[model samples]
Target: MATEKWVFMVTAQTPTNIAVIKYWGKRDEVRILPVNDSISVTLDPDHLCTVTTVAVSPAFDRDRMWLNGKEISLSGSRYQNCLREIRGRAGDVEDMEKGIKIRKKDWEKLNLHIASHNNFPTAAGLASSAAGFACLVFSLAKLMNVDEDPSHLSAIARQGSGSACRSLFGGFVKWTMGSKEDGSDSVAVQLADEKHWDDLVIIIAVVSSRQKETSSTSGMRESVETSLLLQHRAKEVVPKRILQMEEAIKNRDFASFTQLTCTDSNQFHAVCLDTSPPIFYMNDTSHRIISLVEKWNRSEGTPQVKF
Candidate 1:
C-alpha cells in the first residue's frame, strides 16, 4: 500500500492594541513581565490585524515562517519561545477521509510552515508586535486544538511581546502585573467592551512617527538606571492613577479620562527627562500638536475633543 502526503492548516486574525497606561519597564525580562500594570484599547480587528496561516505537512523538514509575505528569520528569541511553548501543547489531529493521522507525539517531529500578513502599515508607530503575536498564538491554538481560553493564551503571547497580552480581547483591557515569581498570573482582563461607552470618540494623530532613535526597551532601561523620578512614579504615582483610571472607565467619565491620560503622559515625559542622558519619546512636533489642541479647546470654551 502507498501512503499519501497530507497538509493541514489553520488561520486566525488578531487586532493591535494601544496602551492608555503604558508599559514602561519589565520586572521579569525573560518572561516579558511588566513593572507596573497597563491598560489598552484593542483597535478594530478589521482595521488592523495579523492573519497567520499555520500548516503542518509530511513534506516539511524543519520549522519555517513568513511575515507580511516576506520570509523572516525565526531565529529571534521571541519567535523561538512562542514556537516552543505552542508546540509543547500540541494535541491530536486526524482526517478520516484522507486517512491522515497526526498523533500527539507526531507534533514534536512534524515541522511547521507559517505565513502571516498584517493589514496596517508595520513601519507606523502602531503596535504591530501586539497583533502579530496574538495572531500567532490564536492560529496555532486552533491548529493544535489547545483548550485554553483567551486569557491563558494571552500569557503565551506575552512571552512574544510585553504589550501583546492585551490584544487577545477587544475594547478596554488591563494587563494585570501578577505577583507570582513564575509570571503565571500576568495576563490581560477586559474592563469594558466597545459598546460600553458609545458616545466617546477616540482620535490618534501621528505628528511624525519617524523611527524613534532609542527603542522603548532601551529608553526605559536607561530611565530605570538613572531617573530619580522613575522610582516615585512607579512606587507612588501609578498605583493611585490606575485606581482612578479604573473608576473613570467604570463610570464612563470622559472628563476624568482626559485629565488622567494627559497627566500621566506628562509625568512619563518628566521621568524621561530625569534620566541621565534624557530619552525623549515625544518630540517637539508632539508638543506643537498638544498646543494646537489646547488652543482649540480654549476657543471652544468646553472640551470639544470628545473621544
Candidate 2:
C-alpha cells in the first residue's frame, strides 16, 4: 500500500455527565435505547473527563485499543457497533503536509489503534463509560472526517452507552427516548448551556471508590424483569418528572431542580429495592449524606444542594 508508512490520528476529550433524571431501564438492549427520557448535567471537562487518541494506519494488522495504559480487546459488540457506525459516515480526507489521502471507501479496510485514559476512576459510579464512549466517537469522527453534527454523532455514542449520548454536549442535556424502532431519532439535545445555570455549584463526595457490585446495565435488566416499580417509574413517574425537570432547567429554578432531582433519585433507588434480588447501591454513608442534605434543605426552607 502507498500509505504503509503514514499514520493519521485525532485526539479528543469528552466530559462525564450526572443524570438528574436517571436512565434505569432499557427498551432496546441492542441499541441501548432507554424506556424513558433522561436528563443530565455534563460536568466540566477539566475536572472529570476522558482523553482518547485514535490513529489509523495501513501498516497495522488489526483494530486494537488500550484503556488506561493497559491493552484491552475491541471484540465487544459495543466497540464494534461504534466503530461500524463511525466508519460508515466517514468522508474522504487528504493531508497535503503528510502526503496521505484516505478515501471514504478506504475506512472499512483500515485498522485503528485507540488509546483512552480517564481522569476519574472507572466503575466508581462516575460515568466513566459515558465519557469514554463519547471521547472515542468524537475522536474517531475527527480522524475519519465524519460530516455528522454532534447530535447525529450522539446517536452513535448511544449504542456504546445509554448515558453516553448526553456527554456529547455541554451543560444540561436530555436523551430523548424516541419511539422509532431503529433508534435513529433517539439522540441527545441541549436543554441549557453551561452558562445558563453556572451559579449552581456541584460538590461530589466520594464515600467509596470501590467498584459497585452491580453494573447499571445488569441491574437495569434485573429491574425490568423483576420489579413492577420499574414499569411504573418508566411509564408514569418519569414522563411527568422529565417535563418538570426540563422546565426547571429552562427557567433556572434551583428549588424545582433540586426537588425533582432528589425525588427522581429516590424513585430510582426505590425501583432498585423492588428488584428480586434487591440491589443495594447506596451504603450507610450514602444514606447519611442524603439525610444531612435533606436536613439542611429543610432547615433552609429551600434546596441548597442536590444529592
Candidate 3:
C-alpha cells in the first residue's frame, strides 16, 4: 500500500421496487434465496431511492459504513457477503492525474468507507433495504471497476437483501428462485423496460413512516417456520401467479395485472398473519385505503383502480 493519502470514491443511485408478486419467505436464508419466484417494478430514482457513496483509502483501518449520516456496524453477514463477493472480482484501477494506482490484489487489503441515504423512510415496509443494498454494491462495483454485468451484480446484491436483486433493473423484473444450492442461478431478469407500460400509474400511500416492529428478514423466517400458508404459497400459489403476472406485464393487460397484483398482495399479508403470533404490516389507514379501492372496483365491475 502507498503512503499517499489518496482517496478514491464512487457514488450510485438505485431505486426501490414494489413487488407485485411478493417474496415473503426464504428457502435458503444464509444466501438470501427466496422460496418462490417473485416479480417487481422498480420505482423512479427521482424519488424514493437510495444514494450511496463508497470510498477506498489506505489511511482507513477497516471496512466501515454510515447509513443516513449515522455510523453503522458492518459486522452483519449480509454486508460481509456482499463485500467478499465484490472484492473477489475487483479489477485494477489507475488514475494518471491523481498519481494513484490500485492493483486487483490491493482490493483485499484496502479498507472501504461507505455512506448511504434513502429518500424514503427506512424499513417501513418500503423496501428501503433493497435500494440501500443495491446502491451499496452498485457503487462499490463502479469504484473497484469490477467487470460484471448487471445480472451478475444482482446476484451479489441478493445476498445483502432478497428484493435488492430486483432493483438492479429498471422496469418489470423477475427474481427466479433458482433450483441450486449455491444460489448462482437465482438472479433477477428484466421483463420489460421502463416505458413498456407507460400508461399505468402508481400511487403510493404513506400511512406510517416509522420503522416496523418486525423486520422483513425476521418476519420471513418466522413465517417460513410456522405459517402453513407460506409453504403453500411458495410451492403452489406463487408459481402460477408469477407466470400470469409475467403475461400481464407483457401484454399490458390492466385487468389481469390489477387482479394478480392485488390478490398476491393480499395473500402475502395473509401469510404474514398466518405466522405464529402473527405479523401486521398494514395498519388501519392501509386497510381503509384497500377497502376504498375494493369498493370502487366492485362498483365499477372491474379493477378501475387497484391498491
Each prediction's whole-model lDDT (CA): 0.83, 0.93, 0.93
- For residues 63-142, could you state the per-residue lDDT of candidate 2 as single tens digits? 99999999999999999999999999999999988889889999999999999999888988999999999999999999
The C-alpha RMSD of each candidate to the native structure, in angstroms, is 2.3, 1.1, 1.1
lDDT of 2: 0.93
lDDT over C-alpha atoms for residue 37 of model 3: 92
After superposition, candidate 3 runs with Cα above 4 Å error: none
Error of 3 at 288 (Å): 0.7
Evaluation by TM-score, superior candidate among 1 and 3 = 3
Better of 1 and 2 by TM-score: 2
If both were scored by lDDT, which would come out higher, candidate 1 or candidate 2? 2
